[model samples]
Target: MQVNINGIETRYVLSNEGGGPWLTFIHQLGGDLSVWDQLAGYFRNDYTVLRYDLRGHGKTALSREAFGMADLSHDLASLLDALGAPTTHVVGMSMGGMIAQQFALDHPSRVDTLTLANTFGGTRPESRALWEQRAASVREGGMASLVPSTMDRWLTPDFQHAHPEAVEPIREVFGHTLSEGYAMACEAVRDFDVRSKLGTIRCPTLTVAGRHDTGTPPADTQAIADAIEGARFELLDAAHLAPIEQSHRFAALLETFLERPV
Candidate 1:
């Protein structure tokens, strides 16, 4: 289904199983709602699962006007309001994780729990430079030039070799991403600086790190977990795309966290 959120046409899917509260899945940079297909299907039988394409990816089209992470968070807020979801368990990875953090910060009462996977809270100088360079490359050479490097960073060589079929779709998603949209999304990450404000997050939080994820290392994820009061942290034996590479394991972890006593 689709809805107009903050003047942008947002595409989303909601699975109602009539059992539990809403669980919303947010994907990584250059990723669409489809990235959460496996995870959402895993939990759909027990929970109402929601997955939506971010502002500039998948079926969603980007506006010519400038927007930032906060704007993305507002879009989410509008989406939840449209769905009449009072509160939800938000699960996010990579850039989506950053958005989840911003969402929780901006709309504290709307988030029941926050699950961050293979993501960062803020940008370091080196990482900022790296993202800026990537944005430049995308603008100059287009998505094709970035696909090879993105695939290398997103999936380990062993996984890529063993799961070529699994990797192809993601590769195509990255390859087909609009350059303007990709560049703007990169700027959001490049300018994001929320490390100091993480302590203000009042929601129950689960921070996950992929052992082989070089894009957002364990140290970065660990810092986020440390900053949030009583946040749980775990490390999975996968690369950047842990939910895809280790679907069962990731689903199990989320189930255990979300189902635990409050």
Candidate 2:
């Protein structure tokens, strides 16, 4: 479905009718709501799962002006408000994690719990450079230049070898993504830095990382966990997109986190 939130048309997919608490899933760069497909079914029996494409990606409309992390954060807050979910357990990965952090910081009262997976707080210089380079490439050649490297960064060798079927959907999603939207999101990541404000997040937090994740390694996840007070950190034996690489374990971990009393 689509909704006009804060003047921009945002596209989202919702699974309602569950009796449990609300859970919102935010995908990383080069991803849409469908990125959460594997993980969403696991929570269908319990939580109301909401997934959406950030502006400039997937089915959402793109902004002509350059966007920052705050803009993406507000987009999410608006989506939640439109859905009548004032507060929810928010889960985000990679770039989505950055948005989730900002959302929690900006709207503390609207976030029940925070889960960040395979993400960073922007403490590394090299990672920032890499993101900038990616932005430059996308602006020059569009999403095609990003496909191969993105696949390498996101998938584990074993999973890629065992499940070739998984590659096509991601490829198609990338093929159809608006270059403008994808480039703008990359800029948001390049300019994003939330390390100094991590202390401001008051919601219960969980940080999950893939032990084999090269894009955003375990140390990046540790940095986020260390900054957030009493945040629980766990490492799964998967790659960057752990939720897709190890769906069963990832879903169980998320379920357990959401079920825990805050």
Give lDDT per model, in order: 0.89, 0.86
Q: Which RMSD values do the candidates have, in order?
A: 1.2, 1.4
lDDT by residue for model 1 (69-122), tens: 899899898999999999999999999999999999999999999999899889
Q: Candidate 2, residues 1-262: lDDT per residue as tens digits?
A: 9999777888898887686778899998888889898788878778888999888888888986988999889988878888888788899998889999999989999889999999998736656777777778888998887788788788877888888888678777977898888878888888888899998887899999998899898998888999988899989998998877878888888778888823
- Model 2 is weakest, by summed lDDT over 10 consecutive residues, at 122-131
For model 2, the superposed segments whose C-alpha errors exceed 4 Å read 123-126
List ranges where model 1 is wrong by over 4 Å.
none
What is residue 29's positional error in candidate 1, in angstroms? 0.5
- Most accurate candidate by lDDT: 1
For residue 151, model 1's alpha carbon misses the true position, in angstroms, by 0.8
